[model samples]
Target: MPIVQVEMLEGHTLAKKRLMVEKVTEAIVESLGVPADKVTIIIRDMSKENFSKAGKLACDQ
Candidate 1:
């Protein structure tokens, strides 16, 4: 079994998220030779304020 975790700033559309999940699953299955059913994907959405870079918050960038 393969577990994939994707964390990003919130606000993506549902269609985009669906496409991402599909592509991620395909890549995992092809690379690890695992069945699609055995793959687990976890998507985490965080506010821009929750992320920072180079001493600046994402929301401030």
Candidate 2:
């Protein structure tokens, strides 16, 4: 089994996330030799305020 964790800023549509999961799972299955059913994709969404870049909060910058 392969577990893939994807963290990104919030606001992506459900369809985008679904496509992301499908593509990621397919990549894992092909590259890592994991079965399609055994590949797990976890998406973590963080608010702009909760994410920082270059020492500044995303929302603040």
Q: Which candidate's lDDT is highest?
A: 1
Model 1 is weakest, by summed lDDT over 10 consecutive residues, at 1-10
Worst 10 residues of 2 by lDDT: 26-35
- Candidate 1 lDDT by residue in tens digits, 1-61: 8998999889999999999999999999998899999999999999999999899999999
Candidate 2's residue-wise lDDT over 2-59, tens digit each? 7778999999999999999998888888887878999887899999999998999999
TM-score per prediction, in order, is 0.94, 0.91
Q: Per-model C-alpha lDDT, please?
A: 0.95, 0.90
**Candidate 2 global lDDT:** 0.90
Q: Which ranges in model 2 have alpha carbons more than 4 Å from their true place? A: none
